[model samples]
Target: MRLSRYFLPVLKETPAEAQIVSHRYMLRAGMIKQASAGIYSWLPLGFKVLRKLENIVHEEQVRAGHIPMLMPTLQSADLWRESGRYDGYGEEMLRMQDRHGRDMLFSPTAEEMFTDVFRSHVKSYKDLPLTLYQIQWKFRDEIRPRFGVMRGREFLMKDGYNFDQSKEDALHAYNRHLVSYLRTYERMGLQAIPMRADSGPIGGDYTHEFLVLAETGESEVFYDSEITDLKFGDREIDFDSVEQCQAVLEEFTSRYARTDETHDEAVFNALPEERRRVARGIEVGQIFYFGTQYSEALGATVQTPDGTSVPVHMGSHGIGVSRLLGAIIEASHDDKGIIWPEGVTPFHCGIVNLKQGDEAADGACEALYGSLTALGLEPLYDDRNERAGGKFATMDLIGLPWRITVGPRGLKNGVVELTCRRTGESEELPPEQAVAKVAEIYAGI
Candidate 1:
């Protein structure tokens, strides 16, 4: 991608309305545009990163054996009515009457819809442990939607529903999702702690919110420091062995962690001072074991081995896909712009043609761009006639993990400079060696 051909409408000054660093930087970098008060149109660059995040979520969900199929954004009110939540869901629910004067809604969540689907197809215990998910847009009608995409009324989310025949089996499904969530955040370069959470509108007794700690976060959370350092790589996933999956979850859950709603003063007091951490955190993902909540209401029953029909025990897991873009920026970024994690970065490397019109600079940049593309690295070539400082600023603002400067001096001398955006370390290497070095560095990141 060339900067001259890109649709990045970067601003010279911060927008006055952006309250947080992530929100402000997102606007200044031209990543998104506000389509309305609580909605946004994701610009090209923003959409690229959003797709990467969604794919990572998809991969992790698939690894946990959850199949994907999309559901509609609008749903019939009769589905909600079966759950007795048509009236109970309150104003956040975007309820309306259709042309036929029948009630409908822009779905805030998909429990009732999934329930209806489950009951329609699977009739026996053999289809008991099924997990289905989708990555789609949802509308909530937030009264005071602010903070850019972080709390937008319309956003992208990955929500999964699990159906099982018994509470114990449903819990096994929940623990698989728990492990999957840990791996999902880990892949995105985030340390998300699973804390007990209030069920809220998604009614359930057992709920866990995967939160990433950031200074600008909305929720107050306390956790043992070790929880942040816990590595998912330490254990292997045995999805078929329910007990083993439960053990892995118990190992991580044993470390003290709780959101404000479930925080225990005694537990906090007992922790050694150095081991404790209290901070604000963003809720990036949430999982709940709502035993028969939607299934019972919607009559999603499966026949048991003894030929008795019972409502399938159920759970739902959600990842705030668009909100994570903001959360990633909040956790990262310095005085410059976003410092994107390599896994979710829109481009792998950015090639700055510091002297765009100069033949040597242009030639070297085009060659390097071709080389990067051949190596499966997406490199943005700043072939626009711009000052070195402006090109550098744009590259930093877009926040590719690696940067290569093809300046007049370097091109003339047969050496190009490769810089690590995160570390600000630069090394001058012959043009022939730059591609291999970048491939090696990015492979490590």
Candidate 2:
């Protein structure tokens, strides 16, 4: 992508409404524009990153044996009524009437709709272990929606539902989701701790919210500091093996961790003084083992071996797909701008033509860009006729993981400057070596 042709309308000054670093940077970077209070239109760069996050969620969910499907943004109010939650869900749910005067809602969640789908076609225990998910836009009318995408009224999310014939099987599905979520967040360069959390309106006795600790987070959390030391890394696991999934669940959750809503002071106090810590957390995902709550309400039952109809054990898991961008920025950015992790960066690296019209510099940048792109990598080339400082500032603001600076001075010495965004470190190497180094850095991710 060439900067001269790109539609990045980066701002020179931060908007007064942006109260946090992510919000300010997102606005200044022109990734999103406010459409209304608490609503936004994702610009090209923002949409690219959003799609990247969505793809990662899909890969991890499918890797864990879950099927992908799409559901409508608007749903009949009858489903919520049947589940006895239409009136109970409160104002956050956008309830309205269609042209026919039928009650409708912009779905805040799809629990009731998914239950209706299950009861309509799935009738036997043979299909009991099925897990289905969708990445879709959801709306919850927040009275005071702030913090950009972090607490927006409309956002993208990946929500999955699991149906099982027995309680034990349902619990295994829950464990599988936990393992998958750990991988998903890790791939996005985040360490989201799974903390015991209150289920709230979702209504579940067992639930865990994956939170990334940031000072700007909304949730107050108490946890064992040692939990931060754990990493999913490259370990292999059989998602279908119940014991293997259960073992991971225990390994990650054995420590003391809970949000303030479910915090047990006694249990927290029992931890070694050095290990106990309190902080704020931004919730990125959650898993719930709600058993028969929705199934019983919606008559989503299956016939067992005994020829008896029974409500299926069920659970819902979710990842805040769009909000993750904010969380990542909050956790990873420095004072300059967002430092996108290689796994989710919009472009693999950037090409800066320090002397835009100079023949040697232009040729070097063009060659480097071609080399990176031919290797199946994306490079953002700042080919605009602009000052060196302005081009460098834009590259830093957009925060590509790596940048290659081509100039007549460097080319005369048979070298180009390759810089790391996160470390603010640079190395002078031949043009091919700069391209090779960037490719090598991103190969594993």
lDDT of 1 by residue, 1-445 (tens): 8878988899879989899988998999888999999799998889999999999999888888999999999999988887899998889999889999998999899988888889999999998689999999999999999999999999999999999999999999889999889888888988888998899888788989999899999999999998877888645687778887888789779888999999998989799999989999999999999998788788899999999999899999999999999999999898888999888999989998877688888889899999989988898888887888998998888788889998888766889999998999999998769899888767754
| CA RMSD of each candidate after superposition | 1.3, 0.7
TM-score of each: 0.98, 0.99
| C-alpha lDDT of residue 15 in model 1 | 89
Q: Which stretches of candidate 1 lie over 4 Å from their true place?
A: 234-236
| Steric clash count of candidate 2 | 0
Candidate 1 achieves a global lDDT of 0.90
Best candidate, lDDT-wise? 2
